[model samples]
Target: MILILGGTTEGRIAASIVDEGEKTFYYSTKGNEQEIALKHGVRLAGALDKKELIRFCREKEIRLIIDAAHPFAKELHDTVYYAADELNTPVIRYERIYPKLDTDVDGIFQHLDYDGVMSSLREDKVRRLLTLTGVKSIAKLKPYWKEKGVQCYCRILDRDSSRELALKEEFPEENLVYDTPDESLDELLKRLRPEAVLIKESGISGGFLEKTAIIRQNKIPIYLVNRPQLKPSARTVDGEYGLRATIDEFLPQFFPLHTGISTGTCATAAARFAYAKILSPSPYVFIDKERIPVILPGGETIPVQIHSFSGSFSLRRIEATVSVRKNGGSDPDVTHGMLISATVSIEWDHTKEMRLLKEGELPEIIFHAGEGVGTVTLPGLGLEVGGPAINATPRKMIRENFEAVIERACVPIYSTPIHVTISVEGGKEIAARTFNPRLGIEGGISIIGTSGIVRPFSSEAFVNAIRKEMEVAQATGAPRIVINSGAKSERMVRNQYPDLPPQAFVHYGNFIGETIQIASELGIERVTLGVMIGKAVKLAEGHLDTHSKQVTMNREFLATLAHEAGCSDETVSAITQLTLARELWTLLTPSELTAFTSLLISRCAQHCQPLLPNGELTVLLISEEGVIYG
Candidate 1:
């Protein structure tokens, strides 16, 4: 949630920006000003003290505070800073843009503070003064003006409260000039015919420029009190766009969140940094080579950070290790916070033991799976029977980044043999939560990433994985392909098809239509789709993309189907009112279950027919009790 401290024009603009979303509160001191309108969730609160402000933030669960108050509101600024510090909340200041003053002008003098303005007035010996500063400081200036024998005329807001305050301060009623929105400052100045004009340097919205122009036109000297210098407690922005950008960066978890670099990209960056450190004498080496911007398969070129590095040099060998922490952005990835490290070692030998490469070829780059790195024991996966679990894309990334750094360092490409071992901390424990064990990847998690970037809830990544799996399965000369919604459904289907190879099982995630279409394009003779009850219902309704955000189960459609299957009105109503699709199985009788499953299978097969025109498509609905229908 956001809290906006507002009153000025910039504050109103900030309020408008936050109004686009819920969970925001707009605040102001003056109740007489125009009230801001917002959506249902946004609240508008009046003035608050330091203690009340902190309590308000705590009660509202405010994550961010925007200080967009008037620049001259020094006490309010201090209070906001104190309250925000107590709450440990991030604050952004929307500062007003002050106009640049021309000190070179004939009779314009700028004073740093109120004292300076008074000192300047004393030296000038002005007979009459017209002050545009607000009524709050009228008492402070009354002494100096009275001592100088200057008749002062003060302009303040035309409000009963303002007049009462001025009168209470002992300021003469005859000299007090009440200002309305429609009043002209030039006419007032002409009527008073003061010797000099004194005004505070409020920003453009405060009419500082207009007052100065009128003073100059009347050939009267103007003394301006410069704005107060208050140190901000948080980051500050001047304009509306800057405020929006800052808000986006601060609270990206809310909406329009940005994607982050993948673990594969982190490993690649670590490999490059490690290789560069071995070649350079300094503690750190910065590579400045341009090679296609190191794009991830997802087509995003994100920046990477080298978290830590260490190196050592021994007889005829140089070794360096670097670590990079993976950032999953807003995605709930298992490896989001894992530290992926790479150790690069270069060995040189003048004897016959050294391996030589052909001309124009690089050194022999060998990859090793260190601790926390998995090894492939399965035949279906696109890896050697016994090799490192690093997938093809990450391997390519590591090789390319290492080669690029070596080339820039001007190292001998053909002489030294480079060995890179990639590892992840606590990877084995992390792998337990994934499908690595089921896929026959033993020891630890696989260093697998097709795109070096991981987008939050990315459908493209899942679709791409399905396509890769299909290609691998087709490469194995498999006549039939198995597609499942998730790991659970895949396991159930695998048990049913014990003879099918591991490569033949593809996890389509939510892209059922895409999987069938890709399988048909790959020339597979048969396709089997394994679905759980939750997704089976959506598929039966012809939803190819079964993500809840894309499509929802239509209870009316289910009722119609149940009625056509010869269920009574009461049974049909129960089916329609059911919250979960799985609940229907418990409510339905044996005959109803048979009729419903048959109808659902026929509808699903009809939808799959267009995607797999050349191949035969089959649907298998499975649950914990085993295959419900096939």
Candidate 2:
């Protein structure tokens, strides 16, 4: 279905994103030197020209191609592009993150290609040179060194194949240095005492900045070769999230479940753009404007859209409003496709909005709840009663993003105060479908996302919701919490815990392991796990996460369980042939039910009890007919 051209870091990143899916793709490299680990990708080594690539695409029926090879691999890039174009297939370029070049800096020389670099070196007549480029460039740089007999030490990989390539180019063997010496690059330059250092614009991951720092320390001029030009119409994406989203657009069924961004990230991106636009020259933005990249908690930046912007200027303050619609990620929660907006107001002299700020308060940024955003009504959720229900991580993200803008805008921290109001359109109606009412959050959805991204079923959002529920349950002083897979099991187990409050019942989806672990970490003394037949079968087999992706139903294991329970050969064989785990109830007789249920509960407890050493654990197996097993 797809082909990925890889051998560099970008290629590895592309492979990781594709591994999240179920379909098998091809990952090709020029040689077998790069070691990679892939789950569903077939590895093909050696190069392919234009005609061969076209034939390969035809044979494999590749509908999409991802070009993630090295930037200097111009021939491969052209071949793949032409082949994909002839086949009428789309291409997604996994581009590397490049730092802006500063030609004004001393000891740095920029050139368009290797010929320019060699011509400049010849003009300067440098005697000693240290090259950090790879072994493949031996022939390209030979003219500059061989013609004048310059002393050049080219650093390359420590493989025999690399040395043979240099020898084939008639380059001296003693002039080649192998990879990974004990000394630092700075120390290497000192030891070699070369007149110049050579490097390519290899971006941040290639250690380009560190190599330049060594050159600056030695005060040696460095020749930097720019990256080769790529096709103008290539579709490029820089973040991992972008790759997944694009793949889904091409192949809808590539991933069983898709991923999405959180409301907090959406709110943050909206506020970041609004604050920047309010201060910049532009005041109006259309829905078709460019996407703005937001920095994630993990330090990776993902581009998000900011639209419906309107800015106005007044005597005391200037304000702008922008909204970001959540993408169609795997998790289609209430907030998905909802508009998370931020209205940012900057008080020029702190005169009009002075009363809103506390006396002597230094933080230039303040947050407020708008129409649809909720307000805290209780103490345990970590916010003052009557305050906005935005969580700590989103608040931190807003402040950090604002600080970057202020630093760039040359605005003093104490000069003006910026107020941001975050709201979700139609949030009040959405809150009814959520657990916000039980958690003492009223009016709308609470801005929440710990990782700023959401995976589909059995994601961090599900686990986070469970943790918050337990916190509220413990705050209510409930002696035990009842955790269930979903509404059906929770309703079946409710009558057993009649005295427990409503907050005591929490749903964990497929996150049985996370639910109990959170209760244990919070020092909750008792936990009750109510699981349906499908998840219970997987949990009994020591699979904590009962998601089908992690573990599926094993008929052979169930046959063993039935045989151990003293079932007849007919019943054992029937279990192995049953389509669903719930069908076991009809197949089992009343005589062997108790022993089978007991063995299943015993096995589930073995893997779950150690997590809650200080607490009492109860595993309840609920049947399709509302039968209570253990």
Candidate 3:
């Protein structure tokens, strides 16, 4: 068994990765301990305080403990070291990986503490200081303002919570700059040339290396404050490196192993249940709840919704109450069993929406509930309730994809769920680019996934979600919209329309029918579909099932196209699905390939007309011959 001393983002992320079948416990701080563990469905072994941790180790038979707590979580890190020694257990320090120095400038220095950092700077020469040390330590340097006579600035998370902290700490509002690594620091420095820059080693998040490099390029000195040293006996690793490396090594067991409860499997099951049955009907209910009224294909039942039937029937529903429980918690005093009763109403009817719903086996929902026991439950037939609120995964995926496209996308992400909550910014432009507006999911993007598993090479789910984006864009009065297949295409699309609202773009993988249907539904005026060759061809041929799992290269179709283009039959049949277009180009010279692309684009325009009868459709064939027939 492993107990992770978690608190920081890296710690939560690491804990989130903890798999079942392996004995692992996440020890959080007093208040957040239960919440963090529950969020990831990892066992919470109470705090990392000596007594609770030691007691938990002995009781749970914890063989190894991971100190993946915050870098500045000094006391907990120390306690784990001492407890491990006392219990004679292996203690691994899962450290955060910090970015290396990527700057070409000179005169930038790194130090161990604030005083050392302050002493090294050019006291009289420094005109402005950019502090990237977050908001916690802003007060420490305020006293120096009178003596140094240098204007100090700090970059922090652009959150209202962070803002509240800044106001409480009396941080200078003018100097309270927001942190964005991609933002042009050169422009910033040019506007306000500082003599020195003060910063903390905030690992990768602080953008330490990039910030330093930017400051150094302007001939400014950087006052790098080193992390504080823990106790000699504290279990330590190479900060972020150790944490990430350990998770990478141990995470596979949770997914593939059969022993112990598997969080991934459980979450996968839950997600499948939600998607297959719950998402369309009772999308409101969660894991650990009882007596959920969920509508299915036929009649409704107060019990459960069943997708598959073992009897001689097409599909069936049962009216039954469901209960959830947990096992193998750190607490030795209480026996584990069902923790909550969730009643679900399952019914069946032949609604077109029900028949057209996405179908696949669901993923399991796993989490640690009250105490340290892990819980895995599938709500395919019913509603699930209990466990900590986990809405960060969807947020992360959304932010990552959005930031990748916008280059400077800065939206505040809440670790918790905010249903019906309003996000003024996320609601404005970016939401139009997403499906949130259509789904009636207000505020920022929804934290999603039942099992927390992303299928390999599958874009069906993502594409299906774009219909919602179209609805949102239409509702927001976006006349001209750009739809791309993935992140790279979205980035390129954004570059093409720099002034367009971020919401005016959508990432629709291969669900050509769904996206176009949304366009038709919304009565869109114009649509620019950016596609890779394979998907465009699928769309050109009117294949609704564009999923890689469902469709493959039609050798006959390719051969026909090849023959029509005067290419050898062997050329079309021999090529892999992914490289078919490029391989088709190989049969012809450069000019012919360009002509073929144009032909494909022209065919695409013809094919899309049926999908968008009254609306204008522009097919942008993105390949070696950039923007072929837009």
Against the true structure, whose lDDT is highest?
2
Where does candidate 3 have its weakest 10-residue lDDT segment?
A: 294-303
Tens digit of lDDT per residue, candidate 1, span 139-235? Answer: 7787776664679889988878788988888888899997875668888877999989888878776777787888899999988888877665587
Please estimate how well model 3 matches the true structure, expressed as its whole-model Cα lDDT. Answer: 0.49
User: What tens digits encode model 3's per-residue C-alpha lDDT throughout 1-630?
Assistant: 566666565555455435322333545543432233232234444445688778878988876676766666566777878888899886666555465443333455777777666666544466567776777767666666435466877777776767888888776788777756555778767866666777776666435567677776787766777776655543345432233333434444432211111122222222223322222333344444332222111111112222221111124332322222322122111212222222222344434224221222111223222222222222111123332222434223322222222222233221221111111212233334443343333333322332122222233434434654565455445668887775445655565666665456775655666777678777897998887776766655667546644665565665565556655445554532323343454455565566566766777677666788878877787763444345
**lDDT, ranked from best to worst:** 2, 1, 3
Q: Give the CA lDDT, 0 to 100, for residue 198 in model 3.
A: 75
Cα deviation of 177 in candidate 2 (Å)? 0.9
Model 3 spans with C-alpha error above 4 angstroms: 7-9, 19-52, 55-63, 70-76, 102-107, 122-124, 139-143, 146-148, 158-193, 213-219, 227-557, 561-630
Alpha carbon lDDT at 19, candidate 2: 61
What's the CA error at residue 309 for candidate 3, in Å?
A: 58
> What is the lDDT for 9 in model 3?
55
How does candidate 2 fare on TM-score?
A: 0.65
lDDT values for all models: 0.74, 0.81, 0.49
lDDT of 2 by residue, 369-463 (tens): 99889999865566778999998878888877776565555533444667999989999898877767766799988998756776565567557
Q: Judged by lDDT against the true structure, how good is candidate 2?
A: 0.81
